[model samples]
Target: MSEPVLELTGLTKTYKPGTPGAVQVLRGADLSIAPGQVVALVAPSGAGKSTLLHIAGLLDLADQGRVTICGQDMTGKSDRIRTAVRRRDVGFVYQFHHLLPEFSAAENILLPQLANGVGRSAAQARAMKLLDRVGIANRADHRPAALSGGEQQRVAFCRALANAPRLLLADEPTGNLDPDTSDQVFAAMMELVAGTGLSALIATHNLELAARMDRVLRLENGRLTEITGQQAGAGFLQSD
Candidate 1:
């Protein structure tokens, strides 16, 4: 069998350790995502969804536990190695589009590939293709200010795919849009990821969206538990 795209065992994170206000964000949190799987992470505010994504994406270090990505163990690795691996293997999307307002959409999408030493022409071609895939190719030359919220987010999605990452992490990716626009953006994102056979872990508050994923897991008490589709709907009631 193919190896899982990501695995976390006994992962834990604590803030202000040994101080009065120290709080534990993750306590023995564990998760795994296989290639081509789309998993939804549901949680209430302050349940550490972002914290967990940060650690999984290699942006933050966990205080304890093990993380393995694409069959490679990450524990005890140097910061430089971790950064390199993250750059080459993981893609991230956040609640905000986070595109640079000054640069054109295509330029923003090409930046990461250029940083990774890909040739300029090659990166531009890839960025344009991704923009086209996300249905925003016409907006490639427009800056963020010239685009609508949904268009900017479509650009962001194209940017995230620039590196062709094996794993994708999204934090409330559709949070700011209206329901109809959110559904469109979500469908486009999922269709693109599915076509590439990439695994994704999405953090979201939308129960309807979460239920449609391959699996749904809820974050509570700093740990993750699989939820049935019926249970997912029930959980959202308490979340609100």
Candidate 2:
């Protein structure tokens, strides 16, 4: 079998540790996402889901744990090495679009590739392809402010995928849109993922959205529990 795209073992994190306001967010949380699999992470706000993703994406480090990406262990790696690995192997999206207001959608996607050393002409072609994949080829020249909410998010999705990373980490990628727009944007995202066959771990509160993924994971009290079969529908309701 192919090695897992992302792995977290014994991940533990504490905010304000050893202080009067210490809070432990993760308690030895463990997860393994195989290549081409899409996993949904469901949790309430302040439930440490963002922390988990940050750690997984190498944006932050855990107090005690190991993060392995594409078969490489990231324990105690230098910031430079971590950044390189993250740029080469991981893509991240958040609730907000966070696109540059001044840059066009295609430019936003192309910039990352340029930073990663791709030539301008090739990056431009790749950008248009990604925008087309997300059903926004015509909006490629429009800035974020000119696009609709769903269009902006779709551009953000393309930007996140510009480098063709092996793993995608998203925290509520569609949380800001209306139900209809969210569904549409999410479908585009899934199609993009399916086309690339990259592993994705998306955190979302929308149970309906979570149920569509290959697996559902509930994160509570800093630990993760897999929910499958009928439980996928009924289990998330308990959080409400």
Q: Per-residue lDDT tens digits of candidate 1, residues 1-240?
A: 789999999999999999999989899999999899999998878989999999998999899999899999999999999999899899999889999989999999999999999999999999998888878899899999999888888888888888999999999999999999999999889888978899999999887888889998888899999898676556542444
TM-score of 2: 0.98
lDDT, candidates in the order shown: 0.90, 0.93
Instruction: Provide TM-scores for the models.
Output: 0.96, 0.98
In angstroms, give how far residue 165 of model 1 lies from its true place: 0.5
**98, model 2: CA deviation in Å?**
0.8
For every candidate, C-alpha RMSD to the true structure in Å: 1.3, 0.9
Query: What TM-score would you give candidate 1 relative to the actual structure?
Result: 0.96
Weakest lDDT window of 10 consecutive positions for candidate 2: 231-240
